[model samples]
Target: MTRMVLGAGTGLAVAGCSREASALMDDYATVSQAANEPVAGLTLDNSQLMGIREAGLQRRVSGFLSREWSDHFVTLDNGAILVDINARALHYWSEDERTYKIYPVSVPLSEDLTRTGKTSVVQKREGPDWRPTPNMLKRNPSLPAYVGPGPENPLGTHALYLGWQYYRIHGTNDTRKIGRKSSNGCIGLYNEHIAELFGMAQVGTQVLII
Candidate 1:
């Protein structure tokens, strides 16, 4: 598993340990070999590395699905979002395609911070401002009371608020954090991927976080 240390303050910059850093070296090699086959003259960079990591995480999630839920990859709703916390990935069921596409995501680093079971989208927001909850403030008193939308905002550019208490499928400014367990409780995805997902999802869309 990837181990990372969360920095203090509002933005929560992620810093990995030596083990993770070493694993990332292997990740670069694996991603580069795959890229060479599909795209000529393609080299792996930090951005691409993150994408590769997401894809790798998705594969692991797929393996789990194959073993446990062979017939289903998402919620019963055609437009639902299924979150696999154990695999640190989110599967978005595309209505038009009639299939699910997995995306790398960040979940609560500690199991205690995460909640499981079914929910639905209650609200959605673009360029959402982030307000540190009381528990978050308790953990990090130095954190700002509120952060407006911008690079520093943890909620990124879009947020799909869930029916569960204080949980949402949101974007993050820190793309590197994706594929790692780092969120306070909510699900975190790359801003670009979230932008795509935000458009497909709607109010009352089912969400199952397992």
Candidate 2:
């Protein structure tokens, strides 16, 4: 996996609500196995290219499939979110079970950075600020000490902080990161998707990453 270095100097431009947003939503609604392939015309490093190829192979060999909400949780009391790392997708179920949504996501760059298990949303923020993790700083000493809420902020428009420290389900200013292995650790969604999720998800919502 290739590390997507996030630094203060990195100028991440927000796509806002555009045609790409609609396309992303459509892609999520009818995600195919081939959706895991690298985006066309998107430049990737050698490691990233290799990772995508391996991921493609793994998907073929395992016949990667989506699971039902009941497969992981007995109930969806306050709603539930399942982050499928292998599929690079996020599944959401409404508390009343009247609504279910699936969104493409960006997972951790590598397995070492990924954490899988049950956790819950502990905090929610709109226009969230960002600070690089200590390890992120150590890996890239040039990263800014802090980034305020704005288009440049990597956290995008909304963030749902999980029970696990430093782990979050958040939006990204750089839409290209979605549906790819690009995040340092957090699971990333499109800004529009996260905004919708933010409106639906409560702080106590259950989350399972697998």
Model 1: per-residue Cα lDDT over 1-210, one tens digit each: 422211111121233224433343222111111111111112333454455355443243232231212234453554767788877767766555455455657778687888998888999999998877788778767666777887667787999999877788998765566666677788987677788888888998777888
Error of 2 at 77 (Å): 1.0
Top-lDDT structure, candidate number: 2
The lowest-lDDT stretch of 10 consecutive residues in candidate 1 is: 31-40
lDDT score, candidate 1:
0.62
Clashing residue pairs in candidate 2 are none
Question: How close is each model in CA RMSD to the real structure?
Answer: 10.9, 11.7
Stretches off by above 4 angstroms in model 2 are: 1-66
In order, what lDDT does every prediction score?
0.62, 0.70
TM-score for all predictions?
0.67, 0.71
- lDDT, candidate 1, residue 71? 39
